[model samples]
Target: MERPFSVFHYGGTTSYDAHGGRRSRDIPAGEAGSGLGGGGLHRLHHHTDHDGRPAPHREAHSESGHGWERLVFSNALQAVSIVSVVQCGVGLSNADVVPKYGFGPIIKFLKVLVVQQILWAVSLSLCKIAILLLYSKIFATRAMVMAARIMAGFTAVWTVITVLIAFFICRPLSDNWLLDLKNRNCGNQPAADGTMGVLNMITDIAVLVMPISYLWKLRLETYKKVALIVTFSLGVL
Candidate 1:
């Protein structure tokens, strides 16, 4: 009698007997292996069916197994990050535009500035929500899940309010870019911006602290727990 084991390859799985003879039907390729041509050990395991036949299993790669929420949030983060970079490039170009183009470009710059502010709020909120979702997924405790949900909701609401404030800070909307427009009534723009900035920082601090309590209660050693907490806290910086 020969012992049987399964070999997982990039394209598919193959099982072999003790004599190196192929024993089972080739398993359809799974998403488990790196696509590199030269195969290395991905995983090795052996199992026998109740009647003494080799049992082959399909293994799912981490990327393929990620939940939809992870995909959605991560893609959204990437999209917003790309847009933010483009906005920064536009901003840099404005320096040259002002020297050559004068006030004509200033309005455009101010408009871009407003959009950039909203983008900042959206990007930050998405990041925080993604982190909170990860916390819920990883910790899975009732308290952690509830806290994550509450914080996520609050971050989303804050983003919505911030965008609204940025968009509507000036009556007639054009007042944001038309600095010299007559009879344009706008809120204290600088003060509103400052308040929003402070609130953003406060949320950052709250997110940083939310996981510390749960981490401290983990069965990890004190030094390990402290290290983990420090790692998570780096997001604030």
Candidate 2:
């Protein structure tokens, strides 16, 4: 962790009846650590699962600790969530800083955003990916996973689309300095665009429908099949 250098500000004595004006005390908005507004809502805290992991949960660990895979996944999810929230808060705080200080401070803040937001977004994506992967635990068969992999592929494609739209697609050139002259003119094509949308619909239907289709192979009641499929689908959505 890096510690920032702090400067001391000394204001003159109080001017108000009760030690007097706004100057009598220091008031900072968005109370962070403790007190009334201390929940630190809309802020990014930490992200341990920077690459890939599932949503957080608590699990019993073996004495060896090496077998604690589930515990690692759950803690990773919590970390990812906190980091994302903190990133959002930091972005919002940039606006407050700009009004109070200037672009000099805000520019430095943007640098932090580059690293933090990337990690936060990755964390959120990893959680979703982890949920999708949880399907493997439900039906750990090669054929089932092949179908599930199709679902995952669509997810990856859609994630890319949303990310592109969120960051680079809007302005194409001016708003984003990262884009180049040749790239700015290269916009999305409708034929290519429809593929992702279709893929998404197909994956959703396939993920749920395939399991039900496979129910004929199992020696279970119609009610049991319906119950199992519906309950599992709930987890997916």
Q: Each prediction's Cα RMSD?
A: 11.4, 25.5
Model 1 spans > 4 angstroms off: 1-100
Residues 111-207 of candidate 2 have per-residue lDDT tens digits of 4433443344344445445555655434444676776676667667665665564455435433333323465543463554476557656655655
Q: Which candidate achieves the best lDDT against the true structure?
A: 1
List candidate 2 segments past 4 Å from native: 1-128, 172-198
Per-residue lDDT of candidate 1, residues 98-127 (tens digit): 677576656655676776677677767877
Give the C-alpha miss distance for residue 146 in model 2, angstroms. 2.1
Which candidate number has the best TM-score? 1
lDDT of each model, Cα atoms only? Answer: 0.66, 0.45
